[model samples]
Target: MSYQFEELFADIQKDNRKVLDDIEPFEHPLVVLLRKCLEEQEYMLDRLIEEFEEGKTELKDIKTNCSALFHANQKVNPYFAEWKRATGWIGYKDDTPSEELMKSLEERLDEMQDDLIEIAAKLDEEYGESTTKYFIPTFYLPEERVN
Candidate 1:
């Protein structure tokens, strides 16, 4: 997760601007994918919060998990806000985008995972080692499960 700040800044400055004086930002194809990704992520977060609430978990535990999820998801918040602005003009569309589009979206999402790792590492390096866990927990794959 060796993050090059220049690379990310360049991505942000890509040619995705509003055509009209007060329009949205869907010029970048990645925005389409990001909108859907945000929805799915929010849905999952809702489910997790509901599960914890149903278990009669302590308030602190619920807050901790929910806050963690929100903070991690907010890493992509800027893109989500951009898509929402676009939707305000064009409403909700796209039940199914092209196969090629979907593939591109998947690739972008993979890149996002790398970005998350890099961000975590950067925070740890600048602040303290404990900062990484504060941002994101150590994840385990299905094969790595103790059970």
Candidate 2:
């Protein structure tokens, strides 16, 4: 695990460290759900790392996988920031991200086409075809993205 991961885990465990319980909620359910998903993912990571350290779970080829995961995580940060800015999720400051940022963001999204397609399919299945018109956006999340 990276030091950044460890630091995040430590903050969650430490009584004196900051907590996010007091943070105000966003107006939109989409933004709120996104934040919740990210938070849950972090918590899962913390648990996985803790289990690995406790000898309760085994890591598969840690040197290779963790390094790859770390590199992927690093690349994800800037793309996520750009996506949030473009979507106006972060704040009122970024009404529009730059053209370069949009291209970079789109490239990252393109990399996840298979996953996006699967998710879209599942969403369509669960919510019905008509529900997708409101929930599954194809303009930003292209239908051509399907693998």
Candidate 3:
């Protein structure tokens, strides 16, 4: 099947609407909190990719960035780590999470997704849809996929 940008965009828009609806009415700080979390995630992810592509993916650098991103995210929204543990989003790790922690993480992910959508929209406007192209190719294995 052919790729469908319109469908993906529509899905993102729907998610944005749901995120707005689900947020607590008086939780005004969530907007900025989520924004910071998303921004850090985006920045760190970009750096991680650049270092990896340049054959400089040192464990120390990776760990440093990962820990910094995690801590920064926790500062703004502690729920991110909790949600990852609760939802098994930790991937290949076997860490048990409490119910309260899971709930908090779920809330943070919901908020963070909205902030990501906003950032993506801004990037798209500035750099065109090609902005997404920067990340997509990195998602695949170089040996298995054509450039």
Candidate 4:
């Protein structure tokens, strides 16, 4: 069953000083519980990472598909064509993507990328620039108990 992690953690943090001050150095129940909760959180965090990876893959596929479609329709509307990387040339005489549609798609893609960056920032403030995971926890942690 699911646990009220926030409440449990908060309550322990509030009583952290007392627990450490009064209890023996041996394994305390609160410490044990908090450790278990953190382990469970690790699993949840792993899932979040997996989902982010999936989203990034999906975004790449969408960008590739858009480029292919634009290239395919370039035969009818050269003005709406994009630069071709392979041939070092601009669009062909394409008609599939009208100027308006291309503009809209570009705008939508930009928005989608922006959204992805925002989510990445939440998972990692530097967005993979730093070595650490940089995940901000949802719950406060109890301080270490010393002998």
Listed in order, each prediction's TM-score against the native is: 0.37, 0.31, 0.34, 0.27
Give the alpha carbon lDDT tens digit for every residue of 1-147 in model 3.
001222332343344344334432323344446545555655665554455555533444454554444444445445444334434543432244445544654664555444444434433444445443343222221333335
**Worst 10-residue stretch by lDDT in candidate 2?**
15-24
* Candidate 4 structure quality by residue, lDDT tens digits, 6-125: 232233233332322322232433334433433333343334334344444333333332223222222212211221121124342342333454455444333433333333333233
lDDT score for residue 67 of model 4: 29
Model 3 alpha-carbon drift over 4 Å, by segment: 1-27, 76-147
| Residue pairs clashing, model 4 | 73-94, 74-93, 74-94, 75-93, 75-94, 76-93, 76-94, 76-95, 77-94, 77-95
* Candidate 2 Cα misplacement greater than 4 A, ranges: 1-23, 60-147
Query: Residue by residue across 1-147, what tens digits does model 2's lDDT show?
Result: 334334433433331111123112333443344345435434544564564456433333232333332333334445455446645554444344445644554454344333334434544554456645454445323454432
Clashes of each: 0, 0, 0, 10
* Candidate that would win on lDDT: 3
User: Can you rank all candidates by TM-score, best first?
Assistant: 1, 3, 2, 4
For each of the candidates, the C-alpha root-mean-square deviation to the true structure, in angstroms, is 13.0, 13.8, 13.8, 25.8
Give the lDDT of residue 79 in candidate 3.
42
Task: Score candidate 3 by lDDT.
Answer: 0.43
